[model samples]
Target: MTEESENTGGLARRTLLRLGAAGGAAAAVAAAQTWAWPLLAQRGLVSPDGAFAAASTVFSDALYIEAFPTSPLILSPFNDPLPVLKALAPVPKTVFSKWPQPPGPGPGQQNSLRNERHQVWTSQVGLPDPIVYKINLLVRTHSFTTSQVLPIDKDGRPAVSFDAKRKTYAAGTKRFLPPSTIYGFNGGFPGARINAEYGRPVLVRFENHLNENPLNLDRQDFGSPDLSFLTHLHNSHTAPESDGNPHYSMVAGPRHRGYRPGMFVDNLYLNRPAGNDDGQKQSFFWFHDHTMDHTGANVYKGMVGLYPIYDPKNGMDMGDETRGLRLPGVRTNNPDGSFDVAYDIPLAFTDFRFDDGVTIHKDFHDGQGEFPAAKNPATHPEWWGKTFYKHFPNHGFVGDICTINGTAFPVLEVKRRKYRFRFLDASVARIYEFKLMTSTRGPKSSASLGYNGEELQGQYRIEDGQQCMQFNEIAVDGGLLPVPIKRDSFELWPAKRREVIVDFTRYQDGTPTTKGDVIYLTNVMKMPNGRKWAASTRFSPDPNYKIPLLKIVIGDTVPDNSLVPTALRARPPLPSNWQSLLDNRLIFEVQRGSAGGELEWLINGKPFDPFHALPSLKNPAGRTPLAQQKKGSFNLWELRNGGGGWVHPVHLHQEEHQVVMRNGKDVTRTPDPGHPDDISGEDTAALDPGESVILYRGFRDFTGPYVGHCHNLSHEDHAMMFAWEITP
Candidate 1:
């Protein structure tokens, strides 16, 4: 949107709301377009069930996923092997030099130096052998990769490839040329994927070229803490050390300033050939720097990647059976026509645009913070994270522009045979709904969005009032958590990824000219955080800026016969945990906010104290990592929701849960969090304004420090999150 156009809209919306404010009357307000209307209705800002224009097109398709090396949220098979922990590094450094000279000038007045402190790791997966995979985590020194590799050693890091004349990284490398957005990550975020498979052991080595920042720079200001990274094979994440826990991060490199492990890192992460059940087949999972305050910059600078672990034992590798269906394959192949690439392909999808001249000021004395990029007072207004962002020619934040395989709408050369597309939503906060555009006459870049659950083969129904109840909406910050931003350009919801398969054989033509299987995978992600980006806050919902996130233009291509979804399933069945809720004996109310000397959170309306444990009957994990303290061995524990600002996803890390009492009622229709494999599904009742709901969660496995917060990443980041111990 242009400046003038935005200004006009802003004035109009604000004026409408302000003028409508009259005494003893409902305000004729104009809420943020993207905010949820249902929430507005509850707040009395708008009438209930108001007509809302379709924000963006919807989708319906069964997505098949393949797990691999890295991850979005690592998903693994149950039989997966234990993880193998190895220390590899090309680790970056946080270099510092004491000002005044030392006693004898022993080392030329050098006071201190430390390797960059971002958590980086490389893991390999092979169906048979442990192969040597060279993984490159070349973080832009002081991270200015979006502008390409700026040669200047700005902020004390190496600027080998950047140009002094242009003040930006070289125009373009192989993947990045022109008309493409530049973000962080060495060879693009999520790096490149080679060969991987389920139930196999492999090794990935890091070429640590990260040097010490001579000019002194804070580590956390740019990317995640360099010293904080864990190679979670996602589903197969084993060892405690490799778990990438916020509290258990470690550093790697020639430098040994890494965090210590109180116990053997014994999750799947520490095993050699990692294997763990991913629970579900068609979803996205991954790995990242879980360090506090470092998540934003680190992921922004490309320290994130995908982990698509496929269950080979499952019928997942039957792509050839579905002749027309394309299968995404990242399998370790034997090459030749006899190799595993038969009908498999890999698509590591991620794109990031950078703020030009990005810079950070820090006192290498200790990894603290950084200086925000400079701003043009006349052009750019002061923003939150902006006060610390330092860089020139900022490209600004883009949840819109997409680069599949490091290029916008990149074309893949596939054989006449079937192929698979392993998709991962690596964006910070965007829910994507993508479709493989194909038509009989030709290819179209759009899909038919008729979310009428009626068009299904089986009569699988959750039948509300009988089996489950629907969730109500809650609004905060003058809006809802999922700030609805759906349009012709993009749809990006926080942390939503989809995996789809495309078959070239079905299309008959590749593009307009070639009559072959040439497919265009188009994505329409919900971009709510756009407002957050503009306001320098990714959590709070605001109606200030609207932007398109991503668009796919095939130019010209032939369509395909049809696209097949993994399963025509809607919601899963509700678990039976609710039956035991009557036995609850312990209950607590959790709240969050920045307090005390550092940031703080609370439980039962009280700030969280590390030395304290909310009263509970038994340690759910029996002392294992999944050993969370159970409210009652029978039925004494309860966490009732007191409708407030935001609705936390309230995930119990070790076990799944189900809704039992929503605002004081036994709603059979609520989803069964522990219900396993019964099509009679349900939706978990959501917390309504001033409402109380009851949920039941049974003990599962390993007990360790787990976080229960809003699935909404933004809220979780801004202190609306907390942690608990499941100890006896």
Candidate 2:
């Protein structure tokens, strides 16, 4: 067909499509428009889409610990049913499953293992509602000749130091687990729960044992033995040292890094030189290996975990220190007339796929077209996978299945009282919605507090603070963003912590019994986002990624006598005046491009390719002049999207933004959506895309080393990136 004729024909078809869609309701048309989902998984290449990987290769050995607390292991100590094993590479692919429940036993039990390598592990961890984590990190260097090995001590755990000579790793084009790579927390790979309370600190030791050569990953964007690594603490605002600023990276071999915690913070030190600092906030967040080219490899192999900071002054006991009521209604106190509530429950929700016996770390390229590693053979001496010159690219094939708390279809027992639940969307490219069902089959209180879509903008009336100021200059040292959630009640978001009260007094059996209560936290987001999420389908679907997360259970049920609590976490002494300030700002737009390319999630309009660095955020020009905004002032932002794709967990680097306005209105999605789906309040906003939702603001404490990006690990590492610095 002639170019003009083809264009004309395409235009005509699209017009007809629109006309037909218009006949339907706006929402239906919008939904239908996205129904065309691009043709991403088209290429005739071998894609790992609906596949399965080998199970974990169990590796048993009591990691000898010198320190009393056992000082953590390289990966093991994994409990039964989930024996920590080193599964051989290239295992078949398989999706993860969520059994048991999450927030379980904190560490080893937090997440499940589902591989899309064509394989992965699935399990669950049990924890009291809201849990916090402080992750330490180390990045690995790759070597082609030798399998970039992460050595362990006598007992069978990654040792701080290795017994063999740390040879200079041979460099190879960045791909998944290609020998040596730098990543977050403990070397390469991720875990179940990588989130903490709203504001917390995370400390990591990015030990560069191999003294990686930049040429190893990318000749240009490389690190030194001092090859510093910046940690995004994914979604928090923390101290200058803590902010994941590429500018603040330092020597890893024997260095320690520190950071406070809060929200809307930046990761300025992401790839720049270290020894300096960028002011920012710290909130409930995670830390991942944030090096250039190597990020994909490091993160996929697992290098992420929760990082949070906190003050114990305010007390309530779901699992906290103080004591209070059980459910969500009334107000009571200890012998001392003080309101009380339960500790927020944090559920680190992440999905994985395993292939063969290898879990293609999320972010590792699938060797599909586009980012195919250089086949020069000369450039990479130790390159393996000769048949096709394989390399783990900066992304992984979507996996299938879901898991929570380390268990598949896991269950938890909760009280009829009030409880706080915090959720984290740790999936690679999955958009999720939630649904709480009745265990009428069992005896427990139904959910009163429901789900909230605070992230979506342009649905309801908006309550806000201010826009990101280009001006205001308040030196943030190390504080937190505690933007009061202005609602008649509570709300929740992915990676969000909410204090909710579930009263069972009415459904209670009149008895002085002491049996525990059990509740299930089902996932409806999987199906919704599956059909609703926007992806170009640009290339044919990669087998691994398209899978479900997992189901969860709420446990630790209590009796009516000392059950439901009067208050949730005690308010920080009823704010006399609102606090929390924004030192600077960064707005990111996540979306998908045409077919043949992976879906896109960009900051401004750029991706973070170490090879193709993003535009200079530093005084960016060439575009419309950026308006000078107020600093030290609360800012309001209307998070808008391109629409027609899956959703993303947009996390800020320096401040905790309260979802005030959605769809130009003020409506908050309760923690419970309930029967039918009541989104009546003005605070509720469901961003179908192209619409703006205003999220009110508070303030940030310190400003140095921060970032604003997607919480979805894959996007964060692949490209969707930006920085927000509060220059003193």
**Pick by TM-score: which candidate is best?**
1
Please estimate how well model 2 matches the true structure, expressed as its whole-model Cα lDDT.
0.30
The stretch of ten residues in a row with the least summed lDDT in candidate 2 is 52-61
Per-candidate clash tally = 158, 258
Q: How close is candidate 2 to the true structure, as a TM-score?
A: 0.46
| lDDT score of residue 139 within candidate 2 | 40
lDDT of 1 by residue, 1-728 (tens): 11232132223221221222221012212221335456555656343213121111000000001110100100111112111111122112121123121111122211122222211122333234333333444433321112222111112222222222333334222111122111222444455433334454334333333333333322323443333333333333332233444422322221121222211121122122211323222222445434443344445555555444433445443233333222333333333211233333334444443222222222211212122331122112111111122111111122323444343333344444333434444444334434344323322111111111111100011111010111111111111111111112222233333233433443323332234433334432223222222221222422212211122222233333223433322323344554544543354443432111012223444332222333432323332122246432223234544333333333333333344555556645542232211122111222322445455444323334444433233333333333554443
TM-score of each: 0.48, 0.46
